[model samples]
Target: MRLSKLFKNAPTTNVTGLCFDSRKVQPGNVYFCLPGMTHDGHEFIKQAVEKGAICIVHSKELKPEEMPVGAIYIRVADTVDAMNQAARIFYSKPSDKMLMYGITGTNGKSTIANVIRNIRNKKEPTGYIGTIAIEYGNVRLQPDLTTPDALFLQEKLSEMVRHGMKACALEVSSHGLAQRRVDGINFDVAIFTNLTYDHLDYHGTMKSYFEAKSLLFSERVKPTGKSILNIDDACFEKLQRISQAPVITYGIEHECDYRAINVQILPKQSKFDLVYQGKTYPVVTNLVATYNVYNLLAAIAALHETDMDLDVILEACKNLPQVDGRLEQIDMGQPFHVIVDFAHTPDGMKKMFQFGRQIAQTHKLISVFGSAGKRDVAKRKVFGELADQYCDYIILTEDDPRDEDPAVIADQIEEGIESSNHVFIEDRYEAIRQAIESANPGDCVLLLGKGDEPYIYRENGRAPYKGDNVIAKECISKYCRHINEAVDDVNEDESFIEE
Candidate 1:
């Protein structure tokens, strides 16, 4: 790829690759000086040139004395937009050659994206990009963002194309869309799970957040593509008005194209009567709760829009594997139940508690959670209040405190607790150990927020974590006898969710 070909009004120097990080630059690479909230990429241009960057794309003006001898400098008004263009052409518009599914919402993005990738993967090679990882075929990499920047997204899509993937499902975040991180890719099918109160700190207001999510259906979808939406959500009418593509509606509370009625949530599975086109079919899925019914419907509707056989899709849906870190269970022959979940938002926590209360029934429900620092400080106390309402006991601790003091965050959450049953423990490990150690038989321990994430972010930096589920297992091992892995007949890896 030549600089002149990749960009207008540029030199004709040949470019080998595109990069944003100066440390990762290779010879002949076009290094993009992307701006960030904390650091400016322009400050690293010297290092980029030193590491053999041929073309420098920047938004800020630089002195001629600082420019490398042979490096070509091209100034743009927005380097993010410039990077998106360079990536699209450099990656040869990879998304255009394959099917693309985009899912955006406050919650259930990961679950729905995984569902799409799983269903498509059964027919042909499929890839996924979301909260979990960037995966297709034999490759899997932990993601830095729920939806990565445009450059990484395009690069991964191109890699998927080269890996012989027939389709890809992406979890598009509000931040990603607002930052123009998904500029060039066109979505074949765009799905909106639902919008709720989250990310208000960065977005400033609910209206701003909703508008950011609406961009997917309005601008990113292909002109001929479909928009799969949740008609039951409060923002349904507003989203429908802004969506440019054709809409396929799904809901539980309202009449829609694809609706799940007569829903039943058992401990291990969810049963619902699927209503579509004036016909009804009994649907049984491994997922549970009313919220998951929405996720299942969104995934099925997206697949059905792709012209897949409804019966075949339903059959696949029935046996779908459990989503990692979501409602994840830690069952090591413990007398009581221990569940780990990634519920961080007010809506998500409410749903988790509602489900937990249902599962506990007459049994005690114990909740262990913490609020993240430097984010929507208003919600910290709300989390405590919700837990106080539904939980018999509460253990509040640290959750990605960032730069704020963990003790301060704990105090903020304690302000909402009217009950005398809650305690604040700053150390997450000790908190989990105490909660599990104190629980009696028939009690359910609900671990919230972290999910299966392997690291804990704090004021200093990110510290290595063994994940909530793994830590729960360690705590359980202290009170219970372990099943020998040497026994072939008894598999200790069994889970309540996967059962």
Candidate 2:
């Protein structure tokens, strides 16, 4: 392919592919020399050339002596932006062929994207790209990032279009927006669930984090489309002011375009009256939690603007499926209840405990959770504080202690706990076992962080870790067997009789 389309007749080459890593470079491939957090791709220019990269795209201006002899050297203002443009051209700009909805926030990105996918798939072929997995008509791809890089992202969108997918719902992460991963993709709608204390380690402050999230609505989303805002969030007004598109508000407390009134959160489901445009529509969903209610409202607002029938949307909500590891229950005939969630942030942890306590009622709520290492160390103390207040028993364990000592991480988390009911267990499996073993008949066992994540990271590498759900089910099964044995022994007694 020639660079004339992107660079205005700069140069031409028989480009076979695009790559960032020097190890992946092959003959005729163009290498993007982009700066990353830890490594500078410019330093690897010689290696890329040696590995058969035909062209070098970089931001740094190098002398003739430094440039590779045979490879084409091109300097641009920003290598990331240039790479995105190149990828867009290479992939034929597939984002233009499909209707894309972007969901961004601290807590509800996955759930909201899934809800939109369910509703959209009912009408036409719909695809999804998010934390869990990427899905299209018949393809399911496990992504390395919540949002893949510009090259992979445009390639996926092109594949979706080729597969006859008319629309897609993408979870736009703060890192994705900040790193310009979604640069070339155009969004028809951008939905903000809420902003809380998350990714503070990377963004440095909540303000910066909000700015990164705002980019989705303010820049990537089309101004002619819609921007859905959660009015109840503290960041809503700021985001509304910053958004480029028309804002559609949704909330439970405030009067908005879409409101959920008379909400009832039952044990297995949630019921609410969705008030939109002076009409009341009943929305009963399998998902239970105030946060989930907001997610549903966000999904509804995004779809409603696209002229989708409110009736069809409501019907789809009636049996909305539970997102994996998002407050999912593991019931193997256990006397007590066990719920697992991917609540890593402080705000997410508080909400999970709120829901867990509601279900536990007067019974004890035991929590088994840990924070991610090497990222957001500031939230560890807050996690301890929340667990101290909400849980009767707390077991602090490792989520992903990547290169960080699990004991040190546990100590940081323990510092905020005022009560002595918490125990620091470095091994997650043992921590879960202890929490489950201590559970009473009516008590609830809550597992947070590393919900359905398949691996545990150490200094060496990541190994297949038993997921929270799997461990929870194993514990519950043992308890169920004990319960059954006790019942059988009582039945075998001569004095015992059936009614």
Candidate 3:
């Protein structure tokens, strides 16, 4: 495809490749000047031109004097939108060729996307783009952002097409929506998991946050897409009214297009009756937590809208396993249970605790958690308060302190703990060890906050670190032998007492 054809209304220009990074610019490439939070792409215009960029597309107004002598400079109201459009044309609109289902909301987006991608057989060659990673066929790319830039997104979609993928499940973040990163992709189905107070630092208010998410279902973006929503969410009623696409509702509380009835949240698993189109499907999922039932229902509704056979969907659900870092369980033959969860938000933390309480019968629930620094300070106390109410014991530790003092963040969480059952520990590894040492045969320890994150963000820089799953496994193995020895010692003491 010619570069001239890619620019809908802009002047015709010859280009060889497309790029946003100045360092990657080459002769005949069109350099998209993007404006980011920290740096403006316009600042690198000279570098792009010097590197032999054929044309420039920028969000800001450009004066004739600012343009390179021979280089073409096109100014648009939004460079991000323009880049998305150009990418669509360059990639021949790959999203339209494959069935694309986009999952958006504050939470469950990644989990739902992963579950859907996992259940789909390899025969169709499904691709996934989300917080975890991007998978095209058998190839995988580690994800640096929840959603990549428009140009990169289009490139990935095109690659998926080349690999003969029949479907793609993408986790669309509000940041991606607000920035117009996924502006031109045509989604066959759009999913709304649930909207809660999150990313307020960027969005400013809950209303703004919802609006950013609403952009995904707007007529301009996804006019022909089917909207699968959680009707039980308070924001759904208003969103349903405004959404331009056909709506499909899924939930547990109220009647929806897809509903789960007689849902039982067990410690190790959950069982529910899935009702869709008046037909019932029994589901026994190893993906624990009542919250996951809603996620599973959302995925089912999306798959159903794709016209997949109900039996196929059910089979997929039954075989679907837990997503990594999302409520993953680690067992080392210890009498007690251990779980690692990516519950960063207050709502997520509360839900995990609720599930923990339900499954922790005849056992104590011990929780170890921390808050992310330089983000969402308001939720620190909320996490503490919930941890206090739910867990038998709570340890407030370090998450990603970023540039802030880890101790200060721990104190912020400590403020919400009204119960005397909680302890504050700034060292995360020590906290995990302490929790393990304190646990008895019937106690369950939960490591929360970090999830699958593989690094610790500190003031200096990000340091390589093992994920919660790894740490949990090590802690369990180290403590299980000690637990057995202690048990033997206790038995001998009891025998002497009896004698």
Model number with the top TM-score:
2
lDDT, candidate 2, equals: 0.87
RMSD each, Å: 4.1, 4.8, 4.9
Models 1 onward score TM values of 0.93, 0.95, 0.92
Cα lDDT, model 2, residue 442: 67
Residue lDDT tens for model 1, 1-499: 8898888888888898999989899999998988888988999888999999998988888998768776889989988888888899999999998899999999999999998889888788889999988999999998889999788889899999999998999999999999988988889999998888899999999999999999999999987999999998998998788888899999988899999888888766788899999999999988877788899899999999897889988999887877778887677876677888999999999999988887776778998999898899999989988988899989989999999988888888889889738888988988999888877666779999999888889878888988898899998998555423255433233323311
Selected candidate, larger TM-score, 1 vs 3:
1
Q: Candidate 1, after superposition: displacement of residue 458 in Å?
A: 1.8
Candidate 3 residue lDDT tens string, 1-499: 5566976665566678888999999998999998778998998888999999988888787777678775777778877778888888888899989888888998899899987787664336789998878998789887778988788898899999999998999999999999888888878888999988788978999999999999887743366779998999998988798888989999998988999998876666678888878888898877767788889999888887777777788777765766878988776766666888888887888888876765565569999999888898999989888988888899888898899988899888889888748887888888998898898875678899888778888888788878888888887777657666334422221110000
For model 1, the local distance difference test gives 0.88
Tell me the whole-model lDDT of each prediction, alpha carbons only.
0.88, 0.87, 0.82
Model 2 scores worst on lDDT over the 10 consecutive residues at: 490-499
Pairs of residues clashing in candidate 3 = none
lDDT, candidate 1, residue 482?
45
Model 1: residues with Cα > 4 Å off, grouped in runs = 60-68, 482-499
